[model samples]
Target: MTEDFYCDEVLSDKIQVRKVLETDNVLAYYHTKPFWPVHVVAIPKKHIPSLITLEESDNELLLELLRVIKKVATMVTEENGACRVITNLGDYQDSKHLHWHIVSGEPLKQLFNERLQ
Candidate 1:
């Protein structure tokens, strides 16, 4: 897999995603493999390395992406009562792409199952 899973898979259509919202510059969808009960991912359709890498020229694109994220976040929060918006950075980031996760409820996967035992 590439460092940018979003570009290599999701954007490339190698992995299909169920879309939640879409705009000319943004795409929001249900995570292919959800980590939470209510999990959605919002990303710019165009490939952006990461949030911190965005340049001043990308202001409009950034605004559009944020609008989509806000819409998705509101939907999740209204339906689930609460939600969390998250974005990883640097080494903590699994995929080196500008993506935001709008999630609700406790984790569905036992990601640290082995470590806890």
Candidate 2:
């Protein structure tokens, strides 16, 4: 991640990220930028540096994250009739925390990449 990119670079607070839901190891919230018709971010509150840095202790968190992904997926599909999901890491990662970018409908990759770049 670049020095200019970090957790704070994006939405800073729980309030900044629209109220969605929070599980034990993950915080699922609406993305400030709706890349797709249905967009949300399932992020771990833990200050994890990146995906590769995730530890064995993160297994539970990982599992919960996946579960949140499923829930979000269902909700988006049923409510918005859109289907898409995204998560970046390493050079593509801007935030220090582990966050799953869940999206649906429309092509958002190009714009997202461009803006982040």
Candidate 3:
């Protein structure tokens, strides 16, 4: 995958995503490859690399992104009774673009279970 999948693929339209919520500077969509039964990804429309890379200029954008994430998380939690909000960084991040995942239901892979145990 490219370093910035969200910018190079999803945002650029090279890959299509089912959008859950969208504003001028943010987008919440169903993950192209989901890790959980109900997995949604929220990202800033503008490239921000990673959470650690966020600059002071990005404060407003971050707030907007969080707002979208909160809405998506609330929807998932209301339906599923519970959900998780997750983000990865450094080596754990597959895609460098800043993004948050709102997910519900058991993890589809045993790796997550093994790590938790």
Candidate 4:
């Protein structure tokens, strides 16, 4: 995978995702590969690397991203009664792109299998 999966694959449309919400600057979608029973991902339309990498100039973008996250979280909570919004950085981050996960429910055992082919 590339350093910025969101920019390289997701935003590029190389990887198709089920969209939950979308706006001029943000997008919320069902995870391409879900880890939890109810997992949704939200990302900025523009590349921002990671949360810590955000600059003061990105204040508006950050606010927009948060709005999308909040909306997605609310929907998840309404359906599941509970939900969490999370973001990863540094080593914990598999994708270097700035993205947030609004998820609910327990983790799944086997979401997708590896194909030897």
Compare the candidates by lDDT and give the number of the best one.
3
lDDT of 3 by residue, 66-89 (tens): 999999999999999999999999
lDDT tens readout by residue for model 2, 1-117 = 344232564434524656577776577887766666567888776667767888999888788888988888888888877677777877787665777877776657766787898
Candidate 2: segments with Cα more than 4 A from true spot: 1-15, 108-117
Model 4, position 33, has a per-residue lDDT of 84
Candidate 4 lDDT over 1-117, as tens digits, reads 678888899899998899999999999999988899999999999998899999999999999999989888988999999998999999999888899999897767544343322
Relative to the true structure, how large is the alpha-carbon lDDT of every model? 0.90, 0.72, 0.94, 0.90
TM-scores, all candidates, are: 0.90, 0.74, 0.92, 0.90
Candidate 4 lands at a TM-score of 0.90
TM-score of 3: 0.92
* Model 4 accuracy (lDDT, Cα): 0.90
Off by over 4 Å in 3: 111-117
- Model 3, poorest ten-residue lDDT window? 107-116
